[model samples]
Target: MRKRLSVSKWAITVLSILSLAFFFTLGPASKASATINYGEEVAATAETLIGSPYKYGGTSPRGFDASGLTQYVYKDAATNMKIPRTSAAQYKIGKAVKQNELKFGDLVFYATGAKGKVSFVAIYNGNGTFVGATSKGVKKVKMSDKYWKERYIGAKRVIK
Candidate 1:
């Protein structure tokens, strides 16, 4: 009787695993809705910082530096996932993605000094632009802006 019970339990576990695999592989509606929701959340959070002042090491509505901006944006949009508070620190986290593979909400890094130190991070908004805080304030800038272009290090996608 004990052996029979053990076999039944094994069968139940296997069936449960198979069911989950089928649901994830075949759930089209669920997958699409999740993607749309993520895009909207990222866009909304970015828009909220349209006029925030640039404050080095700041992380709130009152002000934000480059890394602070990235942290705030992701915190608000990414369902509470904690990201590093500085650009260099953020660079050390997340999977490294190629420049050509960058997607919206991805973290783009820029090198600061001659030694290629990561100095800044911006949210890649697609269409060749990114949103970030600069001396002027939070605003959208061209990906090709000379300073950024020269300093471009890489990108990271933390949301996925």
Candidate 2:
């Protein structure tokens, strides 16, 4: 009986080591990870605030303006990253990309303010659509629309 018990213990140890080795080779079957795609993450975060009220200088779920929305989204979505607080400042940090080259999470600017300046900003969600906060509230708008097209200044990609 002792011999049999000893054999069983040895078998159990071997099986445990083998299981660990297998896990090491093929990776864990149910491991939690944090492989974040920052752009998609930012877009997803913005999508959750679809109907949030547009508040002047607001930056939280309670309310959000154009720059406030961008600032909050990037701060929440990306790790260890801080963005500019205003539309013009945000545009200045990112690399200038042509409108056609704009991709998901790219900041689309418009000359909505006086003097045709980059005063408005939106997050481009690809296929010529973008999400932003307007005077009405947070809503998705098409870049090809007459008003947006007329005001369209350019786009900038802040994500690496």
Candidate 3:
């Protein structure tokens, strides 16, 4: 009877120690894995559409216009947040972010036609590049290019 009682206590002690070890090992890892970076997710989703054709008012994988691409990406990547269908309207929805303070999923607007007007929008890809649907097609371009640089209007932060 004494031997059996000691063995039972030993088993309980081993089980408690194993349970604590498992909890400590997996607690933070599970949390880290669950965290979702919405901005990075948007940027990644936009990148997958490179080479997609550009359409005047297109809004799908088939083809996309400047604003259409932005809209589609936001809808597909961040279902919780919705953006307007046009560049001008989109520029209105998000909090204004300065060019120097831009982030991964920020919407960078441009005045391709008239100065001070938001005519085009692109997803800022960090460094100095942005992805957008241009006349040629969906592609990444340098924000420092003479044309883009001069036409830069402002940027908006849609992902918080």
Predicted model with the maximum lDDT: 3
| lDDT, each prediction | 0.82, 0.85, 0.90
The residue-by-residue lDDT of candidate 3 on 96-133, one tens digit each, is 98889888889999999887899999999889889999
The C-alpha stretches of model 1 lying farther than 4 A from their native spots are 1-40
For every model shown, what is its TM-score relative to the native structure? Answer: 0.73, 0.78, 0.80
lDDT of candidate 2 over 60-145, digit per residue (tens):
98989998988888888764469889999998988899987877888899988776799999888778988898888888889999
Tens-digit lDDT track of model 1 for 1-160: 3554346878999999999888888876456653455644675687679799988788987998888988888888755668988898999888898988877888889886665888888888887788888878899888898978998988888876
Task: List the candidate 2 regions with Cα displacement exceeding 4 Å.
Answer: 1-35
- Residue 103 alpha-carbon offset, candidate 2, angstroms: 1.3
Q: Could you tell me the lDDT of residue 79 within candidate 3?
A: 46
> Judged by lDDT against the true structure, how good is candidate 3?
0.90
Please list all clashing residue pairs in model 3, or write none if there are none: none
Most TM-score-accurate candidate: 3
Please list the Cα RMSD from the true structure of every candidate, rounded to 1 decimal place.
11.5, 3.8, 4.9
